[model samples]
Target chain A: MSTFIQQLANGVSLGSIYALIALGYTMVFGVLKLINFAHSDVMMVGAYVAFFVATGLNAGPDPSIASALITFLAAMAGAAALGIAIERLVYRPLRSASRLSLLIAAMGMSLLLEYGGQVVFGPQHRRVPDVITDERIVLGDLNLTVHKLIILGVSVVLMLGLHFFVNKTRTGTAMRAVSQNVDAAKLMGVNTDFIIGLTFAIGSALAGAAGLLVAFHQQGDIDPLMGVYPGLKAFVAAVLGGIGSIYGAMLGGLLIGVAETFVAAYLPSSFRDTITFSILILVLLVRPAGLLGKFKPEKV
Target chain B: MRGAAIKLGFLVVLVGAAIGIDFALREIFNPHWLRLIELAGIHVVIAVGLNLINGYCGQFSIGHAGFWAIGAYASGVLLTVAEQKWGTPSAVVEILLLVGGMAIAAILAGAAGLLVGIPSLRLRGDYLAIATLGFGEIIRNVIVNVDAIGGPRGYHGIPVYTNAAWCIIVAALAIWFSRNLVTSSFGRALVAVREDEVAAEAVGINTTRVKVIAFVVSAMMTGAAGALYAHLDGSLDPDTFKFTKSIEFIIMITVGGLGSITGAVFGAIVLTLLPELLREIHPTLSEYRMVIYSALLIVIVLVRPKGLLGNRELSPSAGIAWLRRKFGKGTA
Candidate 1:
């Protein structure tokens, strides 16, 4: 029972991280209807930025709240800038082109970032600072870590802030409008390009924060290829939650995280991924719209 | 009479070139360069076959590697098992076994393609892409787990029977098949579905059937390529057929010209050789090779969007037309 609770807590932490990344995928897919394959790379870029800022600023071995905030904001900004740049330079011109072109372009961007990042950053893992001090807390049967708690707290805050902004802000409303109907939104005088850029920026910023948090979780180690697996799984989460649904992305992320945790703990670790994918395939065969997604029939 | 004579002359020249080239590859060219050329031909088979599904059929199937993996392992295991039972067969017997091996590989890969295609019939675009990707990953996972074929230790000791001649023949056959396929009515149906699925369906074209056929054909071709690849290396590792390899094929068809066989051929040859060229230019520069290719990919998609050949074919007629305008009294 204690082990179960411990595993459950671990699952929640991993799920929260997945949710942060999935939110980025869901939002970008929501607006552009294009999967930003490079979104996870933005996470790596973010982690790197934070690493540089922390080390460069002479934060020393001990990182306080102020230094952590500095690293966090710097990473977010760097990632946001990257996401916006990719959109403007690579993807914007192909907006009117076929989805295939866009997808290929996105793929190219992903490759460029991965390989270019290797060239630029060198094929080496950089040491990152832990934003929070490590502490293990045992409450009853559950084993909780300070890093996990911080991650959960930060993720919750971000998700809530996102909800508030999207539900209330004018720009966020425009984003929703464009996602719902791009042409219609354009005719209604929504700055579609600006909205799209903003979406990428915001989504990428969240991913960057997730990156730092992840690095912290992993004991201050980050690399260029670190984002690929989590990024792909997050993408799977986004799809499982319904591509265009924010809440669904979060739900899907948590569900996958929990399920993966349980599978790894109770079953052979190798079967974990196979079973996860099989379940996804099976569930998708039944509910193509995903669990929380409604079937929106197109006017063909 | 003149056309028949010209066709005969062309056939003779083609046969002569094949015979001469095989000898030249064996006796003159370095084995290292020959290996590169052989690998390039195998890639051509893969790229062209993938174009049949991705370019012409208008489906985004990225699981070509999965099919390739199946065919390779199938033939590799078959030959390994057979060799144990009956030592190394005679040259003639070996050739026959090779043909039989390719056939079984094709059949099994085509069957797997059919299974993956059913899901593709319903899933559109990226969903199909992911599903096929899942299928590929599943295959790799299964291969790694199965110890019968040496598992992750890598399958080895298969005879290296795949020569430049075999690769060239198969590559030529693949090109021939795709060329004829594109000009046929069935080919037009694929283009129709690509352009507009609803319109194609309304025109009484069975989109599902067309897609399935394309998938099966592509899968079979990929399988043959895999068999050829395995025989070339005389070994197999599940890692070789990863999603990264699938992406490489995608890059090929996209670069050459989607839906264009000639473009795929050109793309395959250019991509295969470009890295080598870069390596020769400078070792340090080679590290930037993928970066350049990826950047070019981005640039092409952004600037041209239609790719090198687009829907256009590179035919002798095009050259003839250009020459006619240049000097045959129709110029400006």
Candidate 2:
């Protein structure tokens, strides 16, 4: 029972990170209908930014709350800038192009960032400065680490903030309108480009936050290609929860995280990565529309 | 009848020329480039095969590497066993056994294609792309886990049976096979499916059958190419056949021109030679080669949209017209 509870806690922490990243993927796919393959790379960028900010500031593992906040905000700002730049420079011009063209361009941006990041960042493992000193917190049979609790807590706060922003804010409403019907939203005097850019910004900020959280939790284990697996798994999570649905992405992330954790605990650990792709194939075969996604009618 | 005779003469000349070049590479050229040329020929087979599904049929499957891995492992395992039983038979017997191994590779790959193609029947566009991507990853993982094939450490000790001659023959056959398929009535059905699946079905085209057959054929060609690659490399590392390699094939078809056989050939050759060409420029340049490669992909899609050759095949008159369009502003 204790093992199961601890595993569950670990699963939720991991799932929260996935959920944060998946939300960004879901939003980008919602507005543009492109996979935005570079979105995951933005998570990498976010992690790197935080690493530079945190470690460059001090060599100590633990930093005060102010330094941690500064690091987090800097990563968020950096990722948002990158997100908008990619959307405006790489994706915007190809908006009216064929789906294949858009897909390829996204892939181009993905490759550009990955290799370019490797070039600029000098592909090597860099440790993220720990913002908080972790302590063991025991509750009943559950063994919870302080960083893990912080991850879960921070993720919930950001998720709630995003939910409220999307549901209530005027700009967020414009984003929804554009997603529903771009032309209609344009005619209604909504600045479509600005909204799209804002969507990218907000989504990327969340990913940045997730990146920092994972960094702190993993004791500064960050690298250039670190985002590839999480990025892909988050994508699979987005797809599993009807892609355009925000809550669906969150739910899907949690489910995949828990499932992966349970599988690893019961089965050989090598199967951990394989389980994500297997679930992807199964979901695609069973429900391409996803759990919460409404089936779209094919236009003749 | 006279035209038929001329066409037959052209094909014979083409094969003879290919064989002549192969022998030249064997006897004359620096042996270093011989390896590159052989690898280029192998990629040509893969590019043509991929074009059958992605370009001609209009399906967006990017799992070419999965079939390539299958073919490599199949060939590697078979050749290893065969060598254990009969150590390096006569040259003629060796070629025959290699051909036999290639056939087995193709069959295994084709079966995998069939399994992947079934889900494709129910999906289209990006969904299909994701499915194929998943299939490729699954194949890689399965191979990584299975220990009899040496698992993740990769299979070694395979002899070098693939050479310039074998590569040329395989590439030539693949080029001709795809060219014929693209011009045939069945090929038109594939184009129809790509254009509009509903319309194709409405016109009595069995879109599913066309998709499945195209996928199977594409897989077989990639598998054969994989066999060549395995023998050339003399060892097979499972990680070498990852998503990146598959994307390279996609880049070839996209850069060449989807749905154009000649375009597939052009893409395969240019892309295969691109890194080699870049290496001559500088070592650092080669490191940033993918950056330039991907940037070109974006630029080409933005400029031509259709591709370098677009839907048009490379012919003398067509080439002249294209040059004129590029250079001649309005008619003189």
Candidate number of the best lDDT: 2
Q: What is the TM-score of each candidate against the true structure?
A: 0.95, 0.94
lDDT (10s digit) by residue, model 2, range A1-300:
789988988999999999999999999888988788888889899999998888777835556878878888999999999999988887888889877778877877777778788888988888886776677999988888888988899899999999898899998899999888889999999999999999999999988888888786678788877777788889889989989899999999998888889989999877887898888888887888888998786667
DockQ of candidate 2 relative to the true structure:
0.64
Best by TM-score: 1
Off by over 4 Å in 1: B1-20, B330-332
Least accurate stretch of 10 residues (summed lDDT) in model 1 chain A? A275-284
Error of 1 at B188 (Å): 0.7
User: What are the per-model DockQ values?
Assistant: 0.59, 0.64
The TM-score of predicted model 1 comes to 0.95
* lDDT (10s digit) by residue, model 2, range B1-332: 99899978987887688778888877887887898888889989999999999888878876789999999999989998889898878888888878988999999999989888877566665777777777898889888988999899999988778888788888888988898898899989999998898899899998888999999999999998888888997899998999878888988988999888788888988887788788898878888888887888888877887789888898899889889989897775
Candidate 2 TM-score versus the reference: 0.94
Please give the RMSD to the true structure for each candidate, in Å.
2.6, 2.7
- After superposition, which runs of candidate 2 have C-alpha atoms over 4 Å from their true positions? A59-62, B1-17, B320-332
Residue A225, candidate 2: alpha-carbon lDDT: 77
lDDT of 1 by residue, B195-214 (tens): 98888989999888998899
